[model samples]
Target: MESTEVLRISRLARIDLDQDEGARFADQLTKILAYFEKLQEVDTGGVSPASHPTDLVAPVRADRPDGWEAPRDLVARSDGHTDEFYRVPRVLE
Candidate 1:
């Protein structure tokens, strides 16, 4: 965490750090590195990495065909309609 190293890192990261800010960040970076070093000493040989900590499963629903249809009155009110669908302008080329 030397001043020269801190200044170089700040420049590389596109940050403006004055002398006092650089000194403060140096001390904070030292502590953060120490914490990561401590974390490295932990035993996690049997633990598996996961997106979430818990073992979760998604619920499935039974699928059945429902004879649902749009009423003719609704279709008659539309600006454009085919036998099976409402038509609109193409959105993309």
Candidate 2:
């Protein structure tokens, strides 16, 4: 990567880089891009693209709400509560 390209990228990212920093980032980005090019050369004819390595599927429980009641003592303690519900300030006009 050229220093000019690095400066352009820094400008796009809203990052202020000095001449020395721009040159350093240019060298680092060049090396990173070279590593990606090296990876592209690897032959994986049988290998399939996967988001995760394991074939295991995540277990999902039923979405139905469980019967649970709040304590009456906790509700009575709140100053802005009506029965079990807390009275919050209206967000929308």
Candidate 3:
């Protein structure tokens, strides 16, 4: 796709991409989508469903009780605090 197409996608997705970066990203995305198209022609004949590639098992450890507790003064140390959330200036604005 061209930079114009990438710019259209950026606008639709609520993103800001500069000219050079948008062109580069368009090239990379074209290549990645081509790879996915290649993957569409594959056949999964006899493969088993797996979470990992290897069959190694992790060693088990004895469970222990947690011994720590939070400070009783919850909001006493806060500056711009709310009921439960802390407010700050928007980072992207």
lDDT of 3 by residue, 35-56 (tens): 8898657787796779988899
Residue 31 displacement (Å), model 1? 1.3
Model 2 bad stretches (over 4 Å): 4-19, 64-93
Query: Which is the leading candidate under TM-score?
Result: 2
Q: Rate the local accuracy (lDDT) of all candidates.
A: 0.83, 0.86, 0.79
Q: If the candidates were sorted by their TM-score against the true structure, best first, what order would they fall in?
A: 2, 3, 1
Question: How do all models score by TM-score?
Answer: 0.43, 0.45, 0.44
Which is better, 1 or 3, measured by lDDT? Answer: 1
TM-score for candidate 1, please give it. 0.43
List where candidate 3 sits over 4 angstroms from the true fold.
43-93
What does each candidate score in C-alpha RMSD?
A: 11.7, 8.3, 7.1
Model 2 Cα lDDT, one tens digit per residue, 33-61: 99889877889899889999899999899
In model 1, which runs have C-alpha deviations exceeding 4 angstroms?
43-93
Weakest ten-residue segment in model 3 by summed lDDT:
68-77
